[model samples]
Target: MEPLIKIEHMYKIYNPGDDEVRALDDVSMEIQRGELTAIIGHSGSGKSTLMNMLGCLDIPTSGKYFLNGKDVFSMTDNQLSDIRNQEIGFIFQGFNLIANLDALGNVELPLIYRGIDKKTRQELSREALRMVGLEPRIHHKPSEMSGGQQQRVAVARAIAAKPPIILADEPTGNLDSHSTEEILQILKGLHEAGRTVIIITHDPDIASQTDRVVQIKDGKIEKDYWNEKE
Candidate 1:
């Protein structure tokens, strides 16, 4: 079977001259379906650029990205948007919840964008919240919740649509240790439940939890290896 994501000889260069910045330099890798992987790097180590490329939020300057065997660069803008909506769910470190919207409402936003019916979206949203242990806080706005609760709501929102891949960029960056563990457990559960979960972070502790770690530095992949967990 083909890998779910494949990139070959990829490069993302900015300015393209004497002062050009190569955010990604000849990077190449493949991610099989249902793998729990981590791409770790420091702040300027090109991990974010790679994340944007993986998420289909940005295109590389050169090279190929095949998502599910489809050439990503060949996609039109609308096609890219549709694929992003249907194939990957994103969880950001900031939670990114709307201050005015309650947990349920926030969780339903993506479904709404996907044109799901009100009744169905509400059902999915509630179920997602329940999965993240936020059933009781369904109607609470972001302002009324703790940071962990808000992040749980964000997780609910990301999973509400059942996207096959969960791309989390520093999902636990803003949380306390307790909250970080909570989020990590949730992500682990998601991985065990058959989703492809990819986490991008600078924290080795976070990377250790994943099955595979791909470390990036200076726009290159420094190491890629599987963790030996007993």
Candidate 2:
């Protein structure tokens, strides 16, 4: 199968001269479609830098990134924004939902940016909520739901557009074991149903649960292993 995401010679430098910090150093990797992969590293290991590149949130100093076969760096800021809004579904660890918006509203947020009409976005958001098994709580605000449910709302928001890639950054960072597993299961379900899911996490257990693990240290990849245990 063709690769869903590819990065070559990626670099992110914080300072120019005497005080140079390489958040990412010559990182290159390929992620195929529908694969569940984990990028694991401690704080300041450049994993987040990698995520920023993959999500098109930041441009690399020097490298190439192709998402679904389109060169990411070749696009302008507005085009990059469109790439983020259309091609990738982001689920952050923080949930990041507006407290004022109910689950349905939170799920509809992204669709609104895509110029989706109210009636269509509402139905799509409702279906996404149902996919995450949160249909009954769609009307509840984020503050009214458990950590897992809020994350589910976030997931619903992500998949509502049916993006080709699901980029999750420390998706379970704030949840208990059960909630973490629940969210993981939902991500896994998405992968099973043919979505490329990349998880950025520090937890070994979480990394192990993924189909493949790529370890990073000091801004470079240490090991790229396909988990036979899976």
Candidate 3:
């Protein structure tokens, strides 16, 4: 079977007048379904750029990218927007929740964009919040919950659309050890349930838990390996 995601010779050059910087250099990668992959690298290693491309948030300057065997660059703007809304979910380091919106509200935002009816959105959002073990905190705002709970809500928001792939960047960076472990368990559960999970982080400890690891250096992939022990 074909890979769920395939990126070939991808390049991203940010040209702001005289300062032309290459964020990604001939980067190539493929991620299979039902796998948790961790991308590790230092600052300016192009890991973030690569993540943006993989998440369908940014287009590459050159080369080909295919998500679910569909050419990413060939997609119309609306199609790409639809993919971002429906096929891929994103969890940011900051949680990125609207401060005033409660957990259920935040989780329901994406479904609302999809034009789903009110009753269906509420039902789906409730199911997603339950999946992340955040059912009890559905009505609580971000500031009203602990960091781990907020992150759990964020994860719920990401998965509410039933996206096939989840792109999480530094998911555990701001959490304490206990919270980190909780978040890790949640991600592992998602992966075990047949979802594709990709994380970008600099923490070796976090990378160790994933099923696969890809190291990047100076905008290029240095190593990619699968961990069968997972």
Candidate 4:
């Protein structure tokens, strides 16, 4: 079967002169559909650059990125925006929820952008909130909720549209250990339900929980391996 995502000899260079820095130095990888993968790297590592590329947020200086067999670089900005909206769900470290919007409202925002009808958006948002164990908090605003609850709301918002891929960047970076565990379990459940989940983090503990780990260092892939699950 064709890989869900493929990147070959990818390079993201900044400045492009004598002082140029290669954020992604000739990196290449393929992710199969429904794989739970982690990309681990420290602060200066190229993981963030890779995440930007994967999420279609930014273009690489040079490389071929094929997402679902479509050439990513060849797409226009509007097309890339549509792809980001329709094909990938993003969960960021800072629970990017609207302060004025309730949980359901936030979750419905993306569906609304997709031009979904009011009735269908409400249903999908409610179901997504339920999946994240936040049904009771549907009407609660972000400020009224705990950090974990807010993050769960963020999760619900991301999955409300049922995108095929979940791209999470340092998803548990701001939470307590308990909250971190909760988020991880929710992500695991999403993976079990057949979503292609990719987590970007510097924590080996988090990476260990994923099915596959891809370690990045100094803008290059240092290692890629599958974990042995019992």
Candidate 5:
């Protein structure tokens, strides 16, 4: 089977020339469909740059990236936006929920952007909230909810469209221990349901939950291996 994602000799450099910094230096990797993986690295270790490349948020300075067999850089800006909406679901540690939008509204925003009709968006948003165990808080805004509840809302917003890949960046950075466990369990459930889940975290415990871990350091891949103990 073709790889779900493939990157060959990828390089992302900032301020190229006299004082250049390589965020990603020649990163070549292939991730299969339905694999639950974690990319672990501390700040300045290039994990964030790798995530940006994987999510197609920023184009690499050189090399190639293929998601689902299509060259990512070959697409136009609008096409890239469409691919981001349809192929990748992002869950950030910051939650990124709008203060004014209620949980259901937040979950529905992406669908709205995708031009989904109101009736279907409503149904899908409700289903997504239910999946995150936030059905009761559907009408509550971010200010009305606890941090964990707000993060759950974020997760709902990410998965509402059932995108092919769930790319999470430090998903537990802000929550308490209990909330972190809750979020981790939800992600695990998604993986169990056959979603391609990629978690970007510096926490070793968080990385231990995934089927595999790729460690990045100094703008290069330092390690890539399955976690047999996990």
Candidate 6:
């Protein structure tokens, strides 16, 4: 099967006066469909830069990125925006939910942008909440739920669109051990259900749980290995 994401000699450079910083240096990678992959690196190791490129939020200065077989860098800004919304779901370290929006509303926010009808959006949002085992908290606001519940709601929001890929950046960074385990299980379930899941994390324990782990350092890949037992 064709890879869901293909990167070839990717380079992202940030310029400040005469100084240039290489956030990603000739990074090449391929992510297959339905596979759970983790990008592990310390701070300033270029993992976040790679995530930005993968999520289509930032374009590389050179090299090529093919997302689902399309030349991502070749797309116009408007087209890239549309693809970001329709093709990829993102879960952040901070649960970026609207304070006023309840669980269902938060999950339906993206569908609203897609111009999905209210009835259908609500139905699908409820289903998403159910998928994350958040049906009982659909009416609750973010402030009213525990960190784990809020993160689960965020997961529901990410999956609500049924996007082919889910990009999670430090998803468990703020949760306790129990919550981290809960979140990991939810992510594992998503992968098992055939969704492409890519995570960026520094935590070895978290990285160990994925189907494959890619270690990066100094803006380049250091190792890429599959956990045979997982």
Writing each residue's lDDT as its tens digit, candidate 5 over 40-153 gives 999999999999989989999999999999999999999999989999999998999999999999999999999999999999999999999999989999999999999999
- Candidate 6, residue 138: Cα displacement in angstroms equals 0.8
RMSD of each: 0.5, 1.0, 1.6, 0.6, 0.9, 1.2
Q: State the lDDT of candidate 2 residue by residue for 11-107, as single tens digits.
A: 8888867998989899999999888999999999999999999999999889999888889899999999999999999999899999999999999
State residue 183's C-alpha deviation in candidate 6, in Å: 0.7
List of clashing residue pairs for candidate 5: none
lDDT of candidate model 5 versus the reference: 0.96
| Higher-scoring candidate on lDDT, 2 or 5 | 5
What range of 10 consecutive residues in model 6 has the weakest lDDT sum?
11-20
Q: Residue 62's C-alpha lDDT in candidate 5?
A: 98
Candidate 3 lDDT, tens digit per residue, 1-230?
99999999998888945888888889988988988999999989999999888878889889999888999999998999988988888999999999999999999998888999999999999999998888988899999999889999999999888889889999988999999999899889889888999999999999999989999998899999977682
TM-scores of all predicted structures: 0.99, 0.97, 0.95, 0.99, 0.98, 0.97
Over the stretch 32-67, how does candidate 1's per-residue lDDT look in tens digits?
999999999999999999999999999999999999
User: What lDDT would each prediction earn against the true structure?
Assistant: 0.97, 0.93, 0.91, 0.97, 0.96, 0.94
List the pairs of residues colliding in candidate 6. Answer: none
Off by over 4 Å in 1: none
Say which prediction, candidate 4 or candidate 5, comes out ahead on TM-score: 4
**Over 4 Å off, model 3:** 16-19, 228-230
> The CA-based lDDT of model 3 is what?
0.91
Which of the two candidates, 4 or 5, achieves a greater lDDT against the reference? 4
Colliding residue pairs in candidate 2 = none
